[model samples]
Target: MEEYKKRIIKAIQYIDNNLDAELSLEKVAEIAAYSPFHFHRIFRLIVGETLQNYIIRKRIEKSAFYLALRKNLSIKDIYHQFGFSNHSGFNKTFKKYYGKSPSEFRKLAPENFHKIQAKQSKNGQIDTVFDQYICNIENLLNWTNMHLKIKVTALPEMNLAAVMSLGIANVESSFNTLVDWAKTENLFPGENVKMISVYHDSFKVTPPDKVRIHACMLLDEPLKRQQGEVFPEIIEAGKFIIGSGEVTLSDFEQCWVSLFLWMKENNYSVRKAFPFEIYHTNFKEHPEGKMAVDFCIPIN
Candidate 1:
């Protein structure tokens, strides 16, 4: 079982690294040290999809990212870069999966979707301007980079001082605001304090306007009652899958994907408790763009 997992992971890594290049079932199977016949069946059984479907899904997802992020690139160019044969083929497949064409997906970006739509009425002026500041991620964490290893462990109950945000698209800003508030209130007593962020709902299942999350710090003592969004809470003791790694803004979602895939492959079921991130270092201060964090998901 373990050997199968390792080989599948290797193939996934090969696929991710070479997405821009030609990726054939034979090539991937070679990377996995399996015959193409055996590899195809095992991949479908383990990953819950056929190898061809996985490749198409990945290509589309990456094209979606380029559609939003790379405004200067023509839609045709973006599809070509991802190995799609032509524009019509890409358009048909993209709309089938995302319910929109590439152009429609780009216009549907949360930051400028309405603005661009309104502008189209008068002068036909559109915001082809790509904003890096836009939190344009929608199901972007399709899969992980395959380097993350998930560990299952038991956690004791935690008392936390939390600052929460509702309906915010940029989660990092919320986290930073909470940490700033904590510092302003002299909440940090020592260097060992654990920083945590509770993800209350799945991005796919919940409306973005109704999404809720809490940024929290482990409290050694009871916090005085406050009237604002920041408050006290407890995380109950439970079993969890923990994946720790250095993450940047670009790959953070992929880390979550890794854990979710790990859970599926290992036959572990997720519990109702919210998945959370535990920060091991001050992310803002990291010299490298990456931050060290343990992605924690409670499971039965």
Candidate 2:
């Protein structure tokens, strides 16, 4: 069973690394070292969807993020980037899955979707209701299985070439697409580009599939205006208590729990805006076992 789980993860990694390339179920199954037929059964039972369906959903979600955030890229370019051969096929598949044409969905989402609507902090004060119940960090570290150091800092306003997606079922793929978009745009000239995730809700209340992930690049100049969309907006300047750590992929939940516990123990109220996970180190350059991230929590 343990070996099967490792195989499944390997299969997922392959799909993630080669989403734009031609991928077949047989090929993916072979990577898992399982017979194609048995692999299909095990994959569906373990991952809850057929491989093709999962891939399609990931592509659609990624394309939707581009449409929402980057105004310069046309629907055609976006479609082709995700491996769709033509615009017509892309449109048809997207409409079928999302129940609206891409253009229409983009136009209506800002007004209709609860997650898309931006709510400014009331009176510029952070809400501390959740902070009341937090136990001390020393106690939390001793009580919890994971421990990490945290620092508080003020972040200045910065512009970002961002791709925003709601109800992101597959974050790894969505994030990879955003990184690719950033690279294609030449947003990171000679400097290292960090990946930031802005969280709007607590993990307990939000399912992983329903989480909002914003992949962003800090920029210097204002973006050139595109024809009919909004460019990157300023991530407002504020005080944030930042948590930095390296965790195995399987231990991500514990990393988050430690951060939340720290925030609670310190009586820090969270701002009801996007919380960003800033990627300080490039994964391509780092060792496979170590992934570094800075979880930036807006505080009062």
Q: State which candidate has the highest lDDT.
A: 1
Model 2 misplacement above 4 A: 1-140, 143-147, 224-231
Clash pairs of candidate 1?
A: none
Per-residue lDDT of candidate 1, residues 1-300 (tens digit) = 546755775677578557768899999999989999999999887666789987876677667655653556788888988888888899988766655678888776433321221112244432233324222233322333334556899999888877555444656665676577677878764678788888754443233543457778888776776324456667889999998877786766567655765665567766746789888876568787777888998888
Q: Write one digit per residue (lDDT tens) for candidate 2, span 1-300.
A: 545655775676577557677778899999989999999988887666788887776677666655654446788878887779987898888766555677876675432222221222456521111222244445556644444558889989877655444445656654665566556677644466666666533343333554545556666775664211123545789888887776555555556666655665566766534667777775666677557877777777
Instruction: Assess every candidate by TM-score.
Output: 0.50, 0.48
Q: How well does candidate 1 score on lDDT at residue 178?
A: 58
